[model samples]
Target: MMYNATQKVISLSGGREIVIETGKLAKQADGSVVVKQGDTMLLATVVAAKEAKPDCDFMPLQVDYKEKYAACGRYPGGFLKREARPNDSEILVARLIDRALRLLFPADYHAEVYVTVNLISADKDIQPDALAGLAASAALAVSDIPFGGPISEVRVARIDGQFVINPTFSQMEHVDLDLIVAGTLDNIMMVEGEMKEVSEEVMLEAIKFAHEEIKKQCAAQVELSKELGKDVKRTYCHETNDEELRQLVIRETYDKAYAIARGASSKHERMDAFDALEAEFASRYTEEELVEKLPLIKKYFHDDVLKKAMRNMILDEGIRLDGRKTDEIRPIWCEVGYLPAAHGSAIFTRGETQSLTTVTLGTKLDEKQIDEVLVQGSEQFVLHYNFPPFSTGEAKAARGLSRREIGHGNLAWRALKPMVPVGEENPYAVRVVSDILESNGSSSMATVCAGTLALMDSGLKMKKPVSGIAMGLISDSATGKYAILSDILGDEDHLGDMDFKVAGTRDGITATQMDIKVDGLSYEVLAKALEQAKRGRMHIMDKITETIAEPRADFRPFVPRIVQMVIPSEFIGAVIGPGGKVIQEIQKATGTTITITEADNKGYVDIFSQDKDGLDAAYARIKGIVAIPEVGEIYKGKIKSIVSFGAFVEILPGKDALLHISEIDHRRFETMEQTGLKEGQEIEVKLIGVDPKTNKLKLSRKALIPKPQKA
Candidate 1:
């Protein structure tokens, strides 16, 4: 096949260059581009239907990110030996790209657009996720689709008190601030990351630093777009707006909608009021007139009038839909040990949102193994969040996990991960599951709060308790008025300009996610919002502490008992035996679970059992295998094999020594049977000598019996 590939390189601030190439791969797709940074490469393709779906009122855009095992020169680890469903990391990257590009498309365009990004090549040093957005944008830019962007995504990490762009995987280890920022040339669209109680100024500065780099990338995409002669996009009319109908709907419903937004304090009441107003407007039109104009009327009222009224009430009147002050937080209450059967359980409620979270302590065997293209590891601590339809008073049937659930779970995980102990400080694997029982707004934040309580209740010694709050921003650029709302409701999050979430302890911010839908959101406004969020977070933290001030003294009595043991590196093979025969025997005999891994050239074994007898039996066997034989030391052993000379005595679990005829006893014995020591007989013996060269131990029964004064 003939290929004509054109490439452009854009240099970043950190001496890193991003190379974009097109006209080489996936030629049948509507648009395709390969983006490379260092050794990492991503191939992004976009395809859109020629016409919009009938009766579709929303953009049917699907974004998928896949990491191929071949990219990292590894085989897929599952039963199929191929890629299956999207993992959490891949889903998150897809969401990042989706959020950045979704709004850039024409709002009325409801065509089924599918964007797929694949990591064709991976580098251990470079992160592929940060480059996915850029690749997707470059693909769209070179295509005929009508998109308003050329957006770019960059990762900024604060390491050793300095901001770094696209830091290597190793460099991220020391970062106190790790943020991924996606933006266009003019404004930032998304911000998500975790921090170590960093100040608001530092976070803002990092974003600014990231924006400068994003601008350069965006410029590169523009140049590429022009080079490909794709500056003009395809034209389509997906919406036929009736100006008269829109005006009529606004005139009849504006005041009523405004009153609904301002009058109703609860979610259900507010929704009911809006629904009644819409129905009243529909009743005014004749049945024949509504058939053709009903869709238009509903659209105008819901998207135009209702949206405007809600935003204006907050911006102009400083009155939120919930009738609370801008900075006021909702009531909060927390309870721990809600479920005695669970290792740790807590229930956190804030206003209408409630999370029932539980924590479980496990051994290393329970660690979750991750096998991605660029990363292969295991997670010792995992957090999962589930939101059922019933949680929000919906009658829809529960399906499976959605992207929102994974994203929310990930956020809560980051908030609590920093406080979790690692290495030898805490050896048990931890798993936290948060079930959103009731949700109006920010159930994820409630999950964070509930997770902290559960961890403490489970007796996991966390560094500090964490609390999270969702903050909203209402801004009017023309009037220079903006409101920073703390503990925003679901309606506020939908109607406001920004939905910002901050999670932290009393000290500072730990994790944050900011999605800005409007322009001109300056650092000053962000600082104010962050400060207000901190106050809200601290208030929530106070409630959590009131419920459980610290981690419990010990784990629940029903939890399994685990003991760690270290054995000599040489003894590891003997303990494991050939094909795990020895360890299997040990577990079967002791009724315990044992996992051994070699660290620092020593075997680190963890023994887990429910009963004390099982734990003690396993511990004893492991200790015996590592024990060294000493001369003149007495031992209780069992006879393994009876020979003409004597018998072989098994001292330790796997250690055995020779007992010759002369050393059998003080009295002479012609045969081993005369001493009455048979195979499987229990006897006491003394270690008389050990061969230095062969490591052979010599055992004698006469040494244990006192010699009769040299007689």
Candidate 2:
């Protein structure tokens, strides 16, 4: 029996079409779909366990986005010729899909789900990231899994004062706003993008425009699900919840939790109060009774009672857990040049969140090389974020980088990347490392503030000073009432309806990320949130400017000195001799590092050294190699060799001139030895003339010497 292949096409606002086809491949999987736009194609497959593990409490969903080398018709980059770990871009795309779909899963349905989307074909014009989220959602739509999705993802870019949905790669270059928005038919679930300091209204309009196109794709997924007879989903009871225990915990803990939330003034104090209340409730139950019910009680009390209590305190009383009113920001303070040896350092503290960031300036040799299948290049600026367990008052051992760290670092990187000066304007490669010393709120935003200060402290002349703020939203869709929070605490982010972070300068937003937890989040609410965010960002920028108004006048003394120059492309090979002999010799002799590259038919050379002497030495060597000998110019020369007729004198590092016996002195000499210009001796010589046809220089020490009658 042969099954007919079904396909559906959704037209975007810009006339580009995404074709989703099913029943063509991967029949063994629970659900699979191939999504194609232009020449790019992505194959997405989703599989779920029949029953969840007994101990599972949350949705164990994992989404992986892989770009195969063969997809672009190229071999793998490394020596093994195989794809290895996922690159940063791929991990980011996978994260976008996970964030959008994770909230849409059924509350009690905790079966392990794995969604894998692989790029099998590539088109230079179309970006693969925009297609990844849609492919993942389509696979889940045709599956018999319990999901609230049939969602779609689209890339929205503002070009030439017009918004283009699903813009091609080339179109992105001209857009001031490049955002990827994911949502169901009614509301947006996730938004992540960078902009050129656009206004609040402009950003909101882009989102609204993206939602209109997304509605069509969502409708297509719904129809395809119906066609596959997957309108009804599978059932799985993963929770052994006790209704009686849940009510008892709520009844006993609601008032106590409310008091804890309302009375506490600080983060640690509020947390301690909540912890004591939970402990008090547990003490009432015996050890044997707790063996079966303590976990359930704790879960229900914290997740249902405590969560509701905290949210209500904000929604009803219009006060945050820390006793701040809505639209209020926490206290902020900043300091620069915190480290003596670092090229640049800053410490930014907002309420309890603190980031100690340092900036390291390097040469082009230090740029990070990216070897991903789709992208092969180097980045001159990089940002890394580190969050230790001690930052949150925990005692756990340190683990390597987590996805949260990567995500936060990426956000801060975007916020500050555009302000950094490019190649010729500033030739140093910059790396910023943000270490969270204390965190009770948005440490990622703290990173942005600290990074700006650090870059400025390092003497980097950025386009502008940047600051960031994280905004929180708590709302009730039924009542149409909500509170927009500024500089929200960690609790607010976990319990609120939205976690929206906006970063920029005084003009507009540079980067933004919003993850909406509640449904039916209207554009009006989003616009209000953006407006609130702007005020908060402005306040933070004021604090940042108070600490340091602009980049420093000079770098710290310990930083490496980098001098750059451009030479004719023809001399590049000569400067870097066969097997890199020339450059290596220069580095060995001058105690410096040299790197050269050909760009635009010119050789760009960067020389780095630690001391003034070393820098001057390398600089002189490079200047000599590219210099043209000027007649009548004087130079301190070393006699390389003496012959019968003349001696070769080294005038410059790489230049030599002929010094005849007669040119050595005005007096006549019988042989070259009579001139007494022995090898290993230094003398001052003048470039008198050059044979135009031979390109050979003629030097004379007699020109600089005083003659008996005419000097």
Candidate 3:
């Protein structure tokens, strides 16, 4: 059998080439493509249902990104020894692809589309995530699906002040700005990344640089698609449109919806008014005639009338739905130390959204362990964001962690991670949990604010307070008119052309996420949005600082305290002992927890205890274990055993020496019994000398007795 495959190669800076090929693997799928760069390869397949599900007025696109353990030549961790549920990293990648692809589908095409991108091969240098989006888009291009894109994604890193596309894992370490940008040949659709307090101008430049590369990759896909004769997409009637009903619904409801939007009422109030207007329109039809007509009525009123009214209201008038002018922020209130029992706690409320966040400090054992195929490590600073049903006034049951939760939490984590102190500056593992008690829009931004306050309340000295704001854009391509709304409401986000979130400190941006829903979104608009976001962030920062200017002077009294010490690497084994016997005994005796790790030729020891005395005792014990004894210093010793020639005395927790009878009181004794020293006896002794040949300590009991006061 013979297979026909079409391939396209895109050459990147530094002479790196990415090969995208189709028709050679997973041929039975509706669309399949293999994207390869160096040893890294991803197999992306997309399949769409032949017909849309009944009453499915929205596109149901599910994107799954998985990495096979075999890709990296490693077995999966755990008892199952197989891949389980998608990890946070995988979900984040899938979200990037889904956000870009979901925007390119035809608005009328409501088919159930599934896109799967799997990392079949791995390379340490080439990150597979940046290629996954390209692979998925290419698969769609080669299929007979009604997709409006042959988009591609690229990761741009500013290393040594130079923009490099799809940088290696090693190069990422030095990057001050790291962004994954996805776009079609004409416009940028999605961007998400973290920065090291970089300026907005620098970030904008990086995005522009990434788009040039994405355009090249997208063009290659178009070329490949034409070669395979798959340029023409299959047509399907997904919607039974009642043109008369659509126009009638718009004609009747558009004015009412516009009035409600212009009223600038609260979120629920506005929602109620819109719902009532739609219900009033449906009241004209009989219940028997409503079943089929109701769906279209709601769809038309929502997708066309309400959206248009909101966008036009914002574009025509500077007033937003909430009555604020463009670039204006919502009201904000903040409180710290709201929870007494928590190590740190805060409540941040901006407009209708509210976040209750708490901070917990723990030992090294509390760090989050990450065991993904390409990433393996532990995180000292962990942030979790949760959005419950009641947050949005929804009556549905709260299920397990959703991809939105992971993506939002990761964004907050990135925004705050750069400020969380690490290493010797902070000795405890930090965990920040933000629960959205109430939400309208930008719950993730609320989380960032709450997390910052909670962390500071916990007495963790953050480098600087970070604040985030979500910006919305309403633009008319024909009129060249746009309005950039600051601190947008949830409704604005749903109806706007862009949802752009920027998080940072007073100095510069730290993290950002943007998704463009419309074409012809210019860089100028983004620049303006970023600037407006910065101002909104600063306004929010004022509220944050008013609540708490800085981290507490110290941790609460009840909070467990951790003391860190560093010792020579050679002493690590002695401190741990055989089977961890030494460390366990120390912990049990001192009522503390001890952890020891070696790095850079030194052992880092941390002792954690709620009781100060216990913490001090554990510190002293470990200090003694690693302490090197001097020949002339005196030490309190414990008699361990006695022999005819001498008694074995422990000078430290684990250090022992021989105390000869002659050195006991400067007198010679025939037997050890004459010295009156017994096991378990404690006495003071002087470390007089060390035997060079034996490398043993020699302790003298009478060396400090004025030596023959006989003098």
Candidate 4:
């Protein structure tokens, strides 16, 4: 028998192992790997397109990590019982892998890289996410495609201020932090994870530990690729040589160039100055050299081309693109109640980025239910962000929530969740949508600011108003220079190395997002950016208050009104009878949602109706259902099963009263002959002093009789 296959397996620390065999499967793919641990196995196959998509400005790198129910030895439930769309957790994992490989790909080369991670097993201890990233990188490395040598993914867990490297599912229980960082051997490129609000020191330590463990995994992948790697062709992107023209340009106009970069504020001003500078530099060169030197010099100095300016802008001089001084904020304009039809609406724009947020408040029934791998719970406060192609001066076909969009929307959602008011008193389901009509930079942060205003405009009484700003770091390795720009603009962000966004209230930070395209940054950079972010956030908040200081006194007229009420145990049956007949009638008549939270001797009823107008109407409408004894009121009574000493009378439909035989006819009724009273007889009775303690109404029929005529 002839076998066309080979196999390789490597064991890792912490009872984890990477069992890989490539020759046995998918040989047609550019590169592929099957990684398994126990029953949990993932087959990652990658293929790069021979030709790039037409009319595409950027490379098409599609990384999809999907989970099949059958892999877990189960079938998907429900009609249309199949897996179609990727769950939220799947989208997040796909994004993590995408970040890891993007840095390794060459800049000029635009090719399609599809990494499909199919689950062939299901062992909870060995999560496929970290391995999926490694497998994707390995596929690219072993393929004929050119990439910078090996990137690996690492998962870090922290428990009690201690970092655990490549932690298992069991260790995650005690962990307050879950961070997955992907980086090359030299530095990190992507970081994405969720934390339970841990300290910065602990967080930093965890990242460090993750990087260390990742190196070993990175090593294993390198070894495997060497054994089975295909010959990869190389394509290099063209870069200008700044040294060749630096001296010439400097001698000609260094003094002038410095002035323009320092003094420029608006983008147009910078463009004008850069154009003038380009012309001056081009004048000093010969026609052929001019063609080479002009672009080289412009590339080294212009906003789009020159990235070293980050260091110059930050370290040498604390000059930002918008000309804000250190610890200063850009212009912030906030307007609440912008949309009349929405429950709550606000528009928050800081500098170039803008987010129009609208809040919709609904009953508990309005909360969305999500069934996913990572989370199976109910969420009351939801924040959604939408970034259309036009927002960034681009045009493309419409597609549902992509990885980038989901990640950004989730970041904004986390930043604002802690500020939402909660508990049984205000058990409302709130949703905030921030439509990014324009995005220059920090659109995610803008969503936070606008969402806060919208919630307040809807009279949500949020715990605190939140504002966010995007901080950028521009480093010049040559001069050991660095600059941290507050509220960075689009051009600055695109050219800069790091996009650090911070959001919170005046007191402390609520959420933060950090993404870098450079080597791993020092804690010093993170600390400085965070400190500066506070200043920027507070400044923006000061501006926001000028527009709307606090939440409105009343909720939006269009929003729903929810209230909680308690009723006696005896009335519960009358309110909700056998098969919910009474409750259904109550809902049909008053158009309210009555949910019984706790029912016993005392019951709590949660009522939800649209607006205070509807709420007040329902309140007046349903109060009579649980009607109690009221003094000085008259009610019809029926003799129901009369007794020897007193007659039991039904009053007000459901209430009952006692009639003594002495008052049967203003005199004694001997053997029930003189009174002429029968069962099911109805009569009008006068209400006396109702026992306030018992809530029972007393009535007297003799008092309404002709007693004055006898006197």
Candidate 5:
């Protein structure tokens, strides 16, 4: 079949080529586009689900990241030799693309949209992720997906704190932050990034810069869509008596919902209040023909009541349901070194929110094995966040890691990575797990604080101890109504205008995450939030310090120790061979990293250990770049060899000496029997003579038999 389409190609200033084509590809799917930047290519296709996934509160959107290996000139590895499980990088990339799309999708619509990005090439210059987001937006634009899309994605980087858009891979290594912002021209949907503790003002400015670029891309998408847009076919939203039932619920439970939202100060009370309201609303539905039908009525009632109560409290009363000023924060308490078995352990609690973090130290062998872009090897440190059903005081099925868990873990990981040591800098392989015992607000930030304390407890020498705080801003009320609260409770976050989490050392910021439902605010509000966060963080820091401010004097007994050393570049090959043959030997013998890096004609090898003895053994094993000590030093020795010229003797560990013929005996003897020395013999010898220049040993058996000859 033939298709009518319009295409545009733009060569950006940095040799980045953008190919925009629509209507030709994915004619059946809702929207699809092939975005090519230099040689890197990605095919982003968007398809909306015909019907909503039942009872799913969240928008059901699926984003997949597929890497075409032929693009990288390599075939997949494994028996299947195909992509199977989603690699961490793929999951993260798909998530990155999903965040941008989620915000643009219609809010009330539950129909699902799936965005799949397939990498056709891996250009050494162009980045795949940047192009993926751009193409996905284009696909959505041309296809009749029921999305408020046409929003664009751009990467904002800071080099020496100066922001740059779409930096190359080489330039990225020097950047302090990698920020990706995806949003419409007028409103922002989402932002995710890693910062090197840049100030809030700088981060805000960078976001602004990214958003401005997004505007231009959005316009481009609009033009492209107009040229080749298709009619979007949308299924009717789930058939429900939403409006009528919602009104019935509001009329029946307005007071109860308000009471649940506004009156409850604690988690348990809130649950009780919500249950009471649910029970009260269920009374009206008892007479339904079908008993199961009551469930639907209660569900509708539960949602409407919750929504009204919260919205009324925020909009009308101007009082947060949590009873805190818009700028007020919940109380905070912190403790470190709480776990005896861990290298480090800490518990940070803000109001009802809590996270218990434990740090385990390990040998380089403990480094997490990962297969991902940017980190194709092992990682020295890993931060894992876990949310159990019990954490919310609920009885629910639990087993696998949900996407929410992975996303939260990753968020905490990115927030704390900058403060972690790098290279051969730290001797410990750190793995921290943050267990969210309870969460109301900013539990991830609490994890950061707890992780820091746990690291210190393990005896790691950090450049500085770090702490984190969740800053909250309530939007309503012009004057005294707005509050910049520190250590916000969960209710504060739900009711507040924004959630701004900042973490870093006392000297400066290390990491931050900001999300708000309200319109983007000016720099002044952000600045104030940051200032307040610091105060809140410091207060928590003091409490942590009181228990164990610094890393312990020693690592936990279960934790491992690591030692590093340098080897000659020439020795690198001797230590590691083709396909890691030699390195494997070292690992089998010493049980350590034995990692090698060469620069400026020099090689460095880092070794790790769990005990002093292991550390010593690893050192001896890899330090074998040179032969053992020289042959001759007068001392007791073992006869390892018995040659006619003399005998090869053991002088020291891994060292052998050849006893000269003349030194073997005072009388001239041509036969080995005349020397009366057997191969298994051990004896003391005198160093009557030796050749230091040639590393040859001359042992005197007859001369040392004692002065009888002289007598």
Candidate 6:
């Protein structure tokens, strides 16, 4: 069978080209495309159900990104040996695609849409995630699923003060700012990245730089769609609306919703009022009529009437739903040392949102090992975020970890990782867990705040404390009026045009994530939002510092202390013994945990214990094992066995030497039985010499005695 493949090539900076080909693979799907850059290839397919499910009011979009072990010529870890579930890295990539593509689908298009991007080939230098979003958008472009985009996503990295689009994995290592920006040909939609305390202007410059490349990629997708004759999309009726009933609902509910918005009630209180208003309107209709019209009524009342009223109230009156000014931040309160048993704990509350974060310190054994196809390493610092149903006042069972949790945790980790001490400065591995006790908006940002507090509370020597704030935008495109809100509420986040989160210290931004819902968002507006966010972050930072000025002076009494030392690389094997027997014995006898890793021709040993005596004992054992034997040094040796000619003495943990019977005393002895030497005895000995041929230690007890004592 022959297939017609339409290809479009986009030239990026540095003469790199991305080739996107469609109609060559997965032809049975609604749309499919293969995106190739260098040796990396991603097969992206999009499938949309022909009809929407009954009562489906929202766009049901699901995006899955998978990297095959075969792509990178590696096998999956663990006993199963096959992919079980999407890891955090894959989930984050999927989220990037979902956030960029979700808004482009028509609001009324409720059909189930699934976008799957699989990495079938891998390049060591090229990062596949930066290409995943482009593959997904290209697939959608060649499909008959009504999408308002041929958008593309690109990673913009700044190295040595210059912006590079779609930087290689190696180039990213030296980047001060790294961002993934997704956009259509004319408008930017989503932006997320971490930075090294970069200024707002620099961040804006990177975004603009990314958009230029996105425009090129998007144009290529458009050209590809035209070549494939897929510019026209399929038509479907996913919504049924009675024009009169919609008008009646709008007319009757608009004023009521506006009044509720102006009332400045709490989150739950406002929710109940709106629900009551909807019930009152639904009561006017008979039960039979409601069976058919109720869904539309609820949808219209919430989406059109209530959303518009809330947005307009903020835009026109400069009053938010919580009755605060456009730039006003919600109240904040914080506490540290909240959990006595934890290594560190803190509670940070901002308005209705609250986070209880705890920090745990561990040795290298507790470091998280990552074994993904493209990336493999261990992390000394980890952050996990949890959002429960009760946090939002919902009655639902808690499932396993969600993609949102991973994404949010990653952002917080990036925000605080820079402040964490590393290497010799921080010997213990750190894990931070943030659990949302209550939430209204920007819980992830709250996690950043609480994480800083908890880390400080745990006696971690953080470079600087980080605080985060979620900024919102309310704009009138027709009137050219807009407002940049600080510390946005949950309702503002849902109804507003933008949800921009900025986290950092007073120095600059460490991490940022922005999702723009509307089009034509100018750079000036973004700059304004960033500046407003800085102020809000400072306010939150003040609250945080007021509660706890800095990290505690020292770790809690129950926290285990780690003592680190270095030894010669050759001695590491002896210290560990054959099959770890020696190290295990030392740990068991001293009640300590010891970890040894060799780097730079040296073995770094970390001993952990809550008991000072145990720590000191383990340290001494390791020190003696690595200690070089000297010719004149004296040691308290333990006699292992008494032979006919000599006794075997262990001067160090594993260093055994022969103590000749002549060295036992100046007076000669005929036999070992005549000498008072016995096995399992402690005696003082001197390292007399080392055999040139065997490199063995020769010890003597008589050498330590004076001539007069011998006489």
TM-score of each model, paired residue for residue: 0.96, 0.94, 0.98, 0.75, 0.86, 0.98
Q: How many backbone clashes does candidate 5 have?
A: 8
**Per-residue lDDT for 348 in model 4?**
91
Q: What is the lDDT of residue 406 in candidate 2?
A: 90
Clashing pairs in 4: 310-474, 311-474, 314-483, 315-482
Worst 10 residues of 5 by lDDT: 624-633
Instruction: Please tell me which predicted candidate would have the highest TM-score against the true structure.
Output: 3
Model 2: residues >4 Å from true position, as ranges?
Answer: 1-3, 13-15, 283-288, 631-636, 660-671, 681-694, 698-711
Which one wins by TM-score: 4 or 6? Answer: 6
Clashes of 6: 0
Residue-wise C-alpha lDDT for candidate 4, range 497-540, written one tens digit per residue: 88877776776556666777766577688777777777788788
lDDT of each: 0.89, 0.90, 0.92, 0.73, 0.72, 0.92
Q: Could you arrange the candidates by TM-score from highest to lowest?
A: 3, 6, 1, 2, 5, 4
Candidate 1 is scored at a TM of 0.96
The residue-level lDDT of candidate 6 at 385 comes to 98
Q: Write the per-residue lDDT of candidate 1 for residues 53-114, one digit (tens) a residue.
A: 77788889999999988987889887889989999999999998998888788879989999
Could you tell me how far off, in angstroms, the CA of residue 238 lies in candidate 5 after the best superposition?
4.9
- Candidates 1 and 3 compared by TM-score, better number: 3
Clashing pairs in 5: 144-232, 326-483, 327-483, 327-484, 327-485, 328-485, 440-490, 456-551
Off by over 4 Å in 6: 708-711
Identify the superior model by lDDT, candidate 1 or candidate 6.
Answer: 6
Candidate 3 per-residue C-alpha lDDT over 309-380 given as tens digits, one digit per residue, 9 for 90 to 100: 988888887878888998888888999888999999999999999999999999999999999898888899
RMSD of each: 1.9, 2.6, 1.2, 7.1, 4.3, 1.5
